[model samples]
Target: MNLLHIDSSILGDHSVSRKVSAAAVVAIVAANPGVKVTYRDLDAAPAPHQSGALLAARLLDPGARSADQARDITEADAVLDEFLAADIVVIGAPMYNFGIPSTLKSWIDHLAIAGKTFSYSEAGVQGLAGGKRLILASSRGGFYGADSPMAAVQHQESYLRDFFRFIGIPDVEVVSAEGVNYGPDHKQKALDGAVAEAANLGRALQAA
Candidate 1:
């Protein structure tokens, strides 16, 4: 099995989400002893955002794509290829001001291409990237689950699910640790919950 591990947190050593993500990777690899891991750190190696130049190239055939434009499209295409090749994808994304980081969003934009990830059909949008598992580890400063009053304020999980669903990846799992900045007491509570959840999921994934 091939696993793609992606992290977008800029916190480096102080990042709780990264620690959690690493733990999940360890769990996954342990379960699948022969699983090959590919890591992509968005903060250290950011992907280029799509510009109008690239848009023109995607709309045209390869023969019409300029030398520079073809290179841009080719790079983005490679990332998408890696995404498609992975059997499982684990991502660590810390919430920034109630939304996901721009770097992560940029990577999504590069992958969410028409005729590549999805297509507009007579029935509606048909997603092409299916039959894969996506595990998301998200850290937030506040709670947004059903029991929380601010649950409605969460577009993070919903947006990601919607995007992935649009591309045919509906079997998505999320592990969220919120209230990190609330206080040590609250942070510990959330962290503990997150750790337990990660471990459980890791074991289940490994067994599968």
Candidate 2:
């Protein structure tokens, strides 16, 4: 099996999400010996955002695209290709101001290609990239559970879940390490819980 791991935390070594993501990867690799892993550190090498020039090229006929325009489109295309080829996708999504980091969002935009990843029909949006396993290793500074007052403000998890479903990756799971801002006491507890859950999730994947 091939696992694509993407980390989008600006905190670098200090990121809680990155730590949990690494643990999850370790567990998965341990369960499946010889599983190939591909890593994409979004903060280190951010996906290029679509430029006006590129948009113009996409609007035009494919045969009419300039050399530079074609090159730019090809870059994003390659990233999407990597996403499609992976059997499992593990992502580190740290909440930034109640939403996902921009680098992660840029990656999502590149993957959400019309006709390539999904399509429109009379029934509604039909996702083409189905059957892949998606795991979101997320972290937040505050608690935003269903009963919490800030629950409605939490966009990172809901947004990502919707995007994955939009592309037909229905088997999605999230391991959240929340309340880091609640101090060291809560931080340790959250990480321990998340890591344990990740280990179990890894075993489930291996059995499948």
Candidate 3:
């Protein structure tokens, strides 16, 4: 099986989402021997944001695209290919101002090609990448669950859930560590709990 692991945290070693994501990857490797894993650190090598030049290049014929535009389109195509080839995807997402990192959003933009990942027809929209499994390791400074007072303002998890559903992967599993900035003790407890949850989810994926 091919697993694509993505880390969007800019905090490096201090990132809780990275720690949990790594643990989840290790658990999957342990449970399913010989699984191939591809890791992409969005902070280290961020995807370029969409631009008019890029959009025009995509709309133009291959021979008409400028050299730079062609290169950009090629890179975007590579990103889409990687996602399409993956049987499972794991993302480490940290909430920034109640939303996902811009770097991660750029990567999503690369994968959200209309005719590649999805298409519209008489039956409405059809998601081509429907069978892939998605696991998200999320970290937040404050609680944002349904029971939290700030649930309505939460966008990180909700946005990801919607994005995945739009691509036809509706059954996304998220392991989140919330209230990490509350206090040192609370941070430790939340991190530990999220790590454990990631491991359990990894094992469940192996079983599935």
Ranking by lDDT: 3, 2, 1
Among all windows of 10 consecutive residues in model 2, the one with the lowest summed lDDT is 199-208
User: Mind giving the per-residue lDDT tens digits that candidate 3 earns over 70-170?
Assistant: 88788777788889999989999999999999999999998887888888999998877889989999999999999998999999999999988888899
lDDT of 1 by residue, 1-208 (tens): 8898989999997787787778788888888888989999999987767778667778998898888888777778877888989888888988887678898998899788789889997899999989788888889988788788988878777788899999999978988898899989988888788877876787678534
> What TM-score would each prediction reach against the true structure?
0.89, 0.91, 0.94
Per-residue lDDT tens digits for candidate 2, residues 1-208, read 8899999999998889998888888899999988899999999988878668777788888899888788778877878988998989999999999899999998898999889899999999999999788889999999987789999999999999999999898767999999988989999999889988887887678835
Instruction: List ranges where model 1 is wrong by over 4 Å.
Output: 56-71
Q: Could you tell me which residue pairs clash in candidate 1?
A: none
The per-residue C-alpha lDDT of model 3 at residue 147 equals 99
- Computed on alpha carbons, the lDDT of every model, listed in order, comes to 0.84, 0.89, 0.91
What would the TM-score be for candidate 1 when compared with the true structure? 0.89
Give the least accurate 10-residue stretch of model 3, judged by summed lDDT.
199-208
Ranked by TM-score from best down, the candidates are 3, 2, 1
Top candidate, metric TM-score: 3
